[model samples]
Target: MAAKRILIVDDDADIREATQICLEITGEWEVLMAEDGVEGLAIAQLEKPDAILLDMMLPGMDGLTILKKLREQVETQTIPIVILTATAQPNERKNFDQLKVAAVITKPYDPMTISDQIMSVLLTSR
Candidate 1:
């Protein structure tokens, strides 16, 4: 099978690098990193990665807004988007449920398991 391609959109540099290293090294996957939503959108449109791991809180366009924009576009609408949130608060949970995301990955996730977590959701959604 071809190596999976994943795009990660998070503003935090440390988190982005760590996730990239973890996913690339452990999962043997191709990883793309974007620091904000705009760059993320651009990459998503151009690359059409297999999956997107989106951070809930970003500097400019937060996850929800990015998700909406992605959903609106024909090129990116079908790509599985797994949200990463610090907490699954009741209200936020409701919003995510309504958004119908592929999955919600809680923040502070284990680097070792992040790839597996993302894979599980995307596989099931397929």
Candidate 2:
């Protein structure tokens, strides 16, 4: 089987690069990255990745808005989305759940375990 494709959308370059490296090293995953929601959406449409790791806070557009737009589009609606955010409050989790996000990962994450965590969610989601 071929490697899974993952799209990483974040405003922070460090976070995007670190997460990409972790995923690439941990699994047979092809990682694609975008700096902001606008770029992320464009790449998502073009690349049609299997899954997405999106930051809650972004410059051009927020993750929530991006998620909404993604859900609205037929081509991307069923794709798994994991929200990676620094904000892990109760209400934040509730909102993410309300939006039907596949998973929510808090910031200051363990780089070594991030890939495994993502895989776990993807496996269970199916």
| Candidate 2 per-residue lDDT over residues 32-118, each given as its tens digit | 999999999888988999899999899868888999888888888888999998887888788778778999888989988988888
How large is the C-alpha RMSD of every model relative to the true structure?
Answer: 1.0, 1.1
- Per-candidate TM-score against the hidden true structure: 0.95, 0.94
- For model 1, residues 34-105, the per-residue Cα lDDT tens digits are 999999999999999999999989997989999989998999999999999898788877877777689988
What are the clashing pairs of model 1? none
Model 1 regions lying over 4 Å from their true place: none
True lDDT of residue 124, candidate 2: 95
